[model samples]
Target: MTEVPLIAPLWTVQDVSEYLRVPVQTLYSWRSSGTGPPARRVGKYLRYRPDDVLRWLESLDDGAA
Candidate 1:
């Protein structure tokens, strides 16, 4: 049997903010400073990939500390 991989869905700024529990303004600030997960502008809206966001969150985890 072969395993199937799930595809990550793209999220909006508002969605990402809510999921990350951060203010929308903070996400904008991070985007300006290039410190946030990768995002791309689709038309006039900003979109983020779930995979990238999860990876970024994982990077912030501090299990060793």
Candidate 2:
């Protein structure tokens, strides 16, 4: 039997925007300002880990309290 590696699919800027209910432009702005969820430069595009996005959202909750 061969074991397969499990990897979560990274999200595109549009995917993140849709999930967060923000405008696509807003995500780009946040990226420029260095205030959005952490992203990686893959080739010439930005990719986000789902865990990082969820963690960022949880951090916002922490700041609210």
State TM-scores per candidate: 0.78, 0.86
Give lDDT per model, in order. 0.91, 0.94
Model 2, runs deviating above 4 Å: 61-65
Screening candidate 1 with a backbone cut-off below 3 angstroms (N, C-alpha, C), the clashing residue pairs are none
Cα lDDT of model 2 by residue, 1-65, tens digit: 99999999999999999999999999899999999999999999999999999999888745544
Among residues 3 or more apart in sequence or in different chains, the pairs in candidate 2 whose N, CA or C atoms overlap within 3 Å are none
lDDT of 1 by residue, 1-65 (tens): 99999776789999999999999999999999999888999999999998899998888857785
Score candidate 2 by TM-score against the native. Answer: 0.86
